[model samples]
Target: MQGAQRNSLRLLQWMMAASLALPIALFVFTSTISYTSTKDIADREIERTLDVAHEHALKVFETIDRSLAELNEVVRGLPDEIIRSREPALHRRLKRLTDALPQLKSAWIFDANGKSLVNSLASPPQDLSFADRDYFYAHVDQNIGTFVGAALTPRPPYQGARFFGMSRRRETDDGSFIGVIQASVLPEYFESFYARIGSDPGSFFAMGRTDGVVLTHFPRLDRDFRLDPTGPVGQQIAAHPEHGLITIAWPSDGIERRVGYRRVAEYPIYVSAGLETSAIRARWLATMGQHLVFGIPATALLFLLLALAFRRTQHLHAEATARREAEEALKHSQRLEALGQLTGGVAHDFNNLLTVIRASVDLLNRPQLSEERRQRYINAIADAVARAAKLTSQLLAFARRQTLKPEVFDVGERMQSLHDMLATLLGPAIEIGIRLPAQPCLVKADAGQFETALINMATNARDAMQGKGRITFAVQAAATIPDTLVHVSGSHDLAGGDGLVSVAVSDTGIGIPAARLGRIFEPFFTTKQVGQGTGLGLSQVFGFARQSGGEVTVESEVGQGSTFSLYLPRVPTDLLPQRQAPNTAPAVAGSGMSVLLVEDNIELANFAADGLTELGYSITLVDNATDALAELTMDAERFDVVFSDVVMPGMTGLDLAQAIRDRGIRVPIVLTTGYSQALSQDGAAGFDLVQKPYSIEELSRVLHRAARLRPVRDGAAE
Candidate 1:
């Protein structure tokens, strides 16, 4: 429970973090959008203010410029006498001109000597030399076109007042130097016009020239006409082009603003407008706070809900995993119980066979034994040994490790051979049925495993029927089908279609349950009482069928009994030609052919040696293949045949046989083994082979055949 809670908490933490993070990210995005939109709106408002300021400032300059032009034209016709005399008409014209132009403070003319000829506002002092003025030198030297001068203080009547001048040069008819016609406007005129636009509450406007000269500026500076380019506002304007918006602190006032400036066309004046920088930033901050107010709480609520859902899901998954593990543990315990039952059954069967052999040996040990009694004792021991071999073979088959010797044989023939054995195994009470197809069901597999599997199925059928029902062992060729486990629902011809060979053992007795049918082939799974069955009979059948490249299937209903079918893959008819069973008749004689008998067991060696001598063969005995090889090496031509027993300790009999041939010795060689593995391809190669526990007659025949056979040539049978 502690582990579960910890995992739940970890999952909830991650989920909550994800949910909250999403909304916070959205909040950031909303703030960014608001900041962008606010900046754009502020820029548009500033641009509009600049437009209005530019129009009014341009209008004021145009009005002043027009009046100057009109004055220049009117004074052009004045003859030489008007300048010589202090004329009343000129005086009246200058005073009336000053009264008509609202912005103009003075209108005057100056002669070639730089003396004031007449004044618009009042009379000027005769001793005042205007030559020192830059405007005077400007008109005297270049005597053409109108010139607008820098702001300056007027002398005498207009004293202590600053104004910017506009002047036109007066020339003779020959284009020679004459006099100047000039007008001036008070700086108050531009300042009053700038104050009216109201672009921003704390905005400033200025008029300047590119040459660092200031005509006039609103909110006036204390400096002279030469504007300071080194100042912040001045530096910003100088670095930019005619008209653009820039953020700069006004050096004259130290107020930061977004300023817009434009140069007037064909005039010495540049007009600039600006708005306070603090106002724009303040408006943007207000918008961002509105988004944050609603967003944070809603995000937290969503994160809590997601964390709860994740914690619930984790609890369900933990319960499901624990349930599955418990089921597997129960299965393991059941299998262990079955294993104990199987071992006890095997021990009981072997003990019975050992008891019979022991009883037979005791009877054979009496000194005065009759011939018929001696034969009976010998027969009992032989029968017990055969039963032991069968028991061990079945156990190996159940384990699926038995060596399989495959051969092409008719299934019908094999079933016919098991007729008497199956009848005796099932007892007299249970009747048997044998079925075979008209055509042969030829297959390649281990014949011994196949026969054992058949007997095992018969025994199982007898048990299912309580030893009183009919048992049928049938052989038939199956129809072509993709799946190995085929359901036979219709009739199939045995001769026409070539497919698998199926051998089925069926019973007309109590049927198996559908649940039990699937598990009948599993080792130690039986319905019988524990001591009555080892449960390996059906398992042996299953292992044999599969290991031989075949399949086993069961079909049953509640009361219709069961049919267990073993399906083996069919072989090509000509792959292995059928061989007739060799005659097991006793050998009549040996033609005195020399034989070297290599047998490891002392009792078996003496028996074989005595038997071979009686059969008239020259016999020699050795305990092992190593000693046999040494004996042959001392006199290579002494033995005509090397009969070695397979499966010795140091060197196997097959190894000795191969070594003799490797040295090019031409004597015939044969091998024998008690185990099935010795009959495999490697053991049976380049020599004749015979199974163990052979009779004296059987050994004699094999030895005679080995000596008669031609020597092996080039590692192959001749």
Candidate 2:
């Protein structure tokens, strides 16, 4: 049955994949064909456009040819004397022809001796000699068909208009040359005509004679336009002769163009038109786009539908099983990896702290140590021990199984105490704000976790803003449960109240993006650059909140900044067991005072007791708090001070102190621990507290201050 089900799931997946992919594949294949067809159509259209323009260009040549042919007819019929008479009717007819063809600048009749006959002008300005002109000189044996001169600017009739002069030799009936009839064609006429036709900006239309002598062109109206017959485009035209289409890099702009050239059989002129390749490609893409616009989305929707169906039917079961296996493997691996890194980071910091302690302790052993130097070393040791204790405190705060000690305390007062430390932590660039409640807003949470979370948030805010921004720590109590928190949780340990305490850390800094907000609390996931972060800070905060039966939520907008709010259950301050004020009295002499020391580590107990004994105190060492309690119970007045480690297998030092006080004993109990959430509270604060790995001097001072001095062990007290 399982095998059949798995086969069905596999078939469903395959069917879904085929559902989306088959059509897309078909579209791709058909689209390729469609695109190719469109491109071909574009090429043909481009060719047709070039051909039409080329035909238009050739028509201009035909007009000039007809005009020349009419002039030939006049020369063949009219006698030299009649034409030379410069008859008004004949001159008007010549001017009418010139006016009809805008390309023709003028038509003139010049005798073989270069004397003007009928120059087509209503009035002659000056006598222009054309005896030196190429057309007049080309008359060889009276057999020259038609002569086209190079570009020239003639006087009067032609004015300053540049054109190629077309001339035909005039002869008498005996086949003797008589005069020359010439017409001027200004290229500007072609330039103006081609401008109205739709073509690419860089495209050109040209009319030239068979001998590679260009007569006129659309562009470069200021000069002659010609093409070399041996060039690629010219060769293509020459090879085809009647009409030719070839793509080539046009010489004028060096852009590839599809050139269409047609040779005019009636007029010894070839008309060539050029269209840029870029214009053709643009047309092709536009055509291809029309087909793809609808096809792509249809494919995507099919894909989405198939994915949803697969996820609903078969993927959920497989995924859940695979996810469980992967999560288990990944969790075990990540725990080991993160633990290793945490251990290394902790050890490195501890090494520095340990070095200070070691150096101070080694120096204190010097026989010739100065009193001032000795004091400095002792101070150094104490400072190192305090720093090391805080480091461990951070570690314990993040420990997975460490039971949180939830207590009710004023949130504002707690934050106010950390203000200076936070300021130093964030640096001078960041401003700190404390928006505390007017009245005490007591919340049930591990105070140490609260402090860590606050510090972590401030640090993150500082980093987000690159150390320059405002961070506000605010606390408030609510009268009702937040509507946003929809579910009532079973682990909700907030002091049974109408609402929870909201402790917020807001910063005017760079905010988190919505997509990354959810994963920010995941361990070993950080946006910070390598070597800049351990990635456990936010995870620790998250763990603290959940473990304490509270919840942390954040609100942020990019550029506007971010706010992290921790909601803890509120409790009445009056309900908390009141603690005595901390003892701040100065240290007294420990000389000859009897001290009972309880430490689980036998070596540590021996060392500490020996130092206390050497300091002129009677020392009684015990391995556990139970033993010390029994000893104290037996003879409570014998010892002046009870110094014990806060952590043990059973009956912690704090428990012993509570037990001692509960039993009506008045022994000044001094406890030593690296870090204990229990000892970090209001009740424990009244007892003299000292961090472990302390030098003899620190130990002496705390014990002296904590001592409820009885008669000296030597029995010499006044």
Q: Candidates' lDDT values, in order?
A: 0.75, 0.74
- Which regions of candidate 1 deviate over 4 angstroms? 1-68, 74-317, 361-366, 369-375, 410-442, 472-502, 529-532, 570-718
Residues 55-153 of candidate 2 have per-residue lDDT tens digits of 775676667767777876776757657775655666788889988887788777777777667756654424667787776777634756766676766
Clashes of each: 0, 0
RMSD after CA superposition, every candidate: 9.7, 27.3
Give the candidate number with the greatest lDDT: 1
Tens-digit lDDT track of model 1 for 182-250: 788777777777777754555667777766687777666787655477865567667875777777876
- Per-model TM against the reference: 0.58, 0.44
